[model samples]
Target: MNRKVGLFFGTFNPIHTGHLIIANHMAEFSDLDEVWLVVTPHNPHKKKSSLLDNNHRLEMVYKACENYHKLKPSNIEFGLSQPNYTVNTLAHLQEKFPTNDFCLIMGEDNLKSFHKWKNHEVILENHEIYVYPRISSGEVKSELTDNPKITKINAPIVEISSTFIRNAIKEGKNIRPLLDREVWKFIDLMNFYKK
Candidate 1:
């Protein structure tokens, strides 16, 4: 009712089918109108070396999401400080786009560690959280009972991950179907993740 828009933040070292599916489903099944793929420049939880450059990752996300009208790739973190934090990004986005209501999109796996994020309480207070199921468990209601902004969605789950794709590429395996053909082609042409 508040012009819902989901902000799905991630490294997107390379955007894959699973990521796309969740975004599409969230928009369709939930109150969200669209989902933005906020491609992070750096994630505090992961090693910086393993991440492809932000531009490359952004390009892959662009190609992967080219066919989807509702899915957008944003380099919002490129202008922010390193080791981007969710709350800070949300605050900045809200200030810049005052009219749009943002919902945080995440998987059940990440929700387990969500409490540890920087100013995570501030995030729950400002945004709605939409989570998808994971292979490890069933749906988990928001752990923080006092926080009413959280909502878990019962959407279709796709177990694929970027880690597996990285491993496949490192092992010299085909990944054309695992990701968008354009994305796979771009990665192949650029020889990304070959090292």
Candidate 2:
């Protein structure tokens, strides 16, 4: 069997401990052999002023996952076309890494709206999806919740958001506890999020 890798896609704009908790929990508790933290590229359509540069964000993810044996940082989406879709990324990753069986790691909240995603059906047909519970208001339909390819994992509900962290940093609040040591150091040294 190919190595089962869970792709946890995110912008990771200065990856925080919440992100690490979910990634680590998935790696340890799920059937996945490895969890790659895929750093999503900033959309060209959105104002780039608020989002950190892609390299900076990727570097933060790299630092955050440094000591975790099962965790890895991936910049696979960076090479893809702007405004890339998950289905396309899945296809490209499958083509490039045939030896690895990739799967999607998503939240229950996202699963509720999975139907609206571009080529959602194709994604479900090809890859397994590991859904983690979230403290969100919504009930997933039985169809999606019952999919054989979808597995619900008992991962912790991390409520931390990158937006909150950024805003706290701007206001000079100490958020070192919310982020990894190396990540905090890198961000402080670079003076990021301090508008």
Candidate 3:
């Protein structure tokens, strides 16, 4: 049987508890062998200036995910071309790991803009998508709701975001609840997101 691996792609400027919670839930409830947090070097849709160095972000993710046996930190996008698109990364991963079946893990908010992504149709055709709910994300439209391959899971919703955490850190506010203990320590040691 082909092992099912969920690709939870994100910038992960700093990995937080919310991320780990969703990943762990996916691993337990979904038909996935493991969930690999694919840390993107650059997200096409997000601002580059707001992001930390890719290596720094990667290290934080590694530190945050150290205790989770099923949650892995993957730097696969670093080797791929700039402005990494989901379709291309999926293709490359399929080629590289032929024995494993790959799935996409995203939030319902992302589903709203899914069509805007490059080659969105091809991505849907090739892989399964597991969408968890986001607090502010309104109802998923018929197009996505009707899709057979899209599996909607009732994963815990945490309102925390990387932007919120970064701003708190920049303002010298406490963000201990938002981040993993080791991740917060790494950020302090490295002086990350400081104004």
Clashes of each: 0, 0, 0
User: Which 10-residue span in candidate 2 carries the lowest summed lDDT?
Assistant: 138-147
Regions of model 1 farther than 4 Å from truth: 43-47, 137-147
Q: Flag the better candidate by lDDT, 1 or 3.
A: 3
For each candidate in the order shown, give its overall lDDT on alpha carbons: 0.83, 0.94, 0.90
Residues 1-195 of candidate 2 have per-residue lDDT tens digits of 899999999988779999999999999998999999999999998887869999999999989999999999999999999889999999999999999999999999999999899999999999999999999998887789789999999999999999999999999999999999999999999999999
TM-score of each: 0.89, 0.98, 0.94
Residue 2 of model 3 has an lDDT of: 96
Query: How accurate locally is residue 22 in candidate 3, as Cα lDDT from 0 to 100?
Result: 94
lDDT of 1 by residue, 16-42 (tens): 988888888887888788889998886
The most accurate candidate by lDDT is 2
User: How much is 93 displaced in model 2, in angstroms?
Assistant: 0.4
Report the candidate with higher TM-score, 1 versus 2. Answer: 2
Give the per-residue Cα lDDT of candidate 1 at 46: 69
lDDT by residue for model 3 over 1-195, one digit each (tens)?
999999998888788899999999999998999999999886555677879888999999999889999989999999987767789999999999999999999998999888889998999999999999897746666788889999999999877789999999999999898899999999999898997
